[model samples]
Target: MKRNPRDIIVRPIITEKTVAMQQDDNKVTFEVAKGTNKIEIRQAIEEIFNVKVSKINVVTVLPKKKRVGRYEGKTKGYRKAIVKLAEGSTIDLL
Candidate 1:
């Protein structure tokens, strides 16, 4: 089934680590749909950014437990993809 690129790529994740990766490793990070795979992610990113994808690394992040006084909660879990763009290709996300 062909899915919308917007649906496949939930949103871009901006963080210090991700920013460092983007600058030094030519990689960008995004929160992708849980059910999506590497091929779908690659296609979505390529289509949305119009850039060549060199490699993809997916990481399943588990929810983190948190507490405030007597209240306890867990942060939502999501999947993140570290996409490495091909040489000479770049996405200006900032």
Candidate 2:
């Protein structure tokens, strides 16, 4: 089935750890939609970056509790994908 561009990817999560890992020359990570699968992620990366993907690993993140003054709530859950590209392939999303 053809995947919607909107459903392809959500956004790049620029976190301190992610940035540190990037500087250390490790894997590149991204926050993807919860319903997106491994194959869909691979296709999305390939289509968006025009680069070859070697391997793709996905993980689900649980919600965290939030407290603001007297208000309390839970954050939304999400899915993350760690995309491993070919040795020479690179994506300049930064």
Candidate 3:
């Protein structure tokens, strides 16, 4: 099934590591829909952000068990994509 660009990319991941990568490696990180693939992520980013994507890497975060007081549960799992942009291109996340 084809997904909308906006629907495929959940949000930009803003973190110390991601920020560092953006500055040094011309790359950006995003939290994306779990069912989305690398190709979808690449297209979504290129279309929505208007940046040329050079490469895409996807990673899945497994849920971890946590205990709060008397309750024991697992945190929600999610997928993240690391998109490397063309050398001369950039995305103004701000």
Candidate 4:
């Protein structure tokens, strides 16, 4: 099935560690839909950023527990993808 560009990519991760990665120049990562596969992720990034994707690595994170005054809950789990572009390719996400 053809995937919508917007559906392929959920959002770019903006955190302390992800920010550091941009500075170090190793790998760029993003929060993606749970059902998105490696091929979909590569195509999405290439189409949106106009860059070649070398490889992709995915990680699944489990939900974490949360507590309120007298209640407890768990945060939603999410999937993250670490996309590696070709050596000379660069994405100016900053």
Summarize candidate 3's per-residue lDDT along 1-94 as a digit string, tens digits: 7789999999999989999999999989999998888888888898998889999999998999999999999999999999999989998785
> Which regions in candidate 1 have their CA more than 4 angstroms from the true location?
none
- Model 2, range 27-83, lDDT digits (tens) per residue? 678889878889889988888878888988898999999999999999999999888
Question: Per-residue lDDT tens digits of candidate 1, residues 1-94?
Answer: 7999999999999999989999999999999999999999999999999999999999999999999999999999999999999999999888
Inter-residue clash pairs, candidate 3? none
Better of 1 and 2 by lDDT: 1
Rank by lDDT, highest first.
1, 3, 4, 2
Which residues of candidate 2, in runs, are more than 4 Å off?
A: none
For candidate 1, what is the TM-score? Answer: 0.97
lDDT of each: 0.96, 0.82, 0.91, 0.86
Model 1: residue 77 alpha-carbon error in angstroms: 0.3
The positional error of residue 70 in candidate 2, measured at the CA in angstroms, is 2.4
TM-score per candidate: 0.97, 0.86, 0.93, 0.90
Model 4 residue runs over 4 Å out of place are: none
**Deviation (Å) of 54 in candidate 1:** 0.7
lDDT, model 3: 0.91
Question: CA shift at 10, candidate 3, in angstroms?
Answer: 0.3
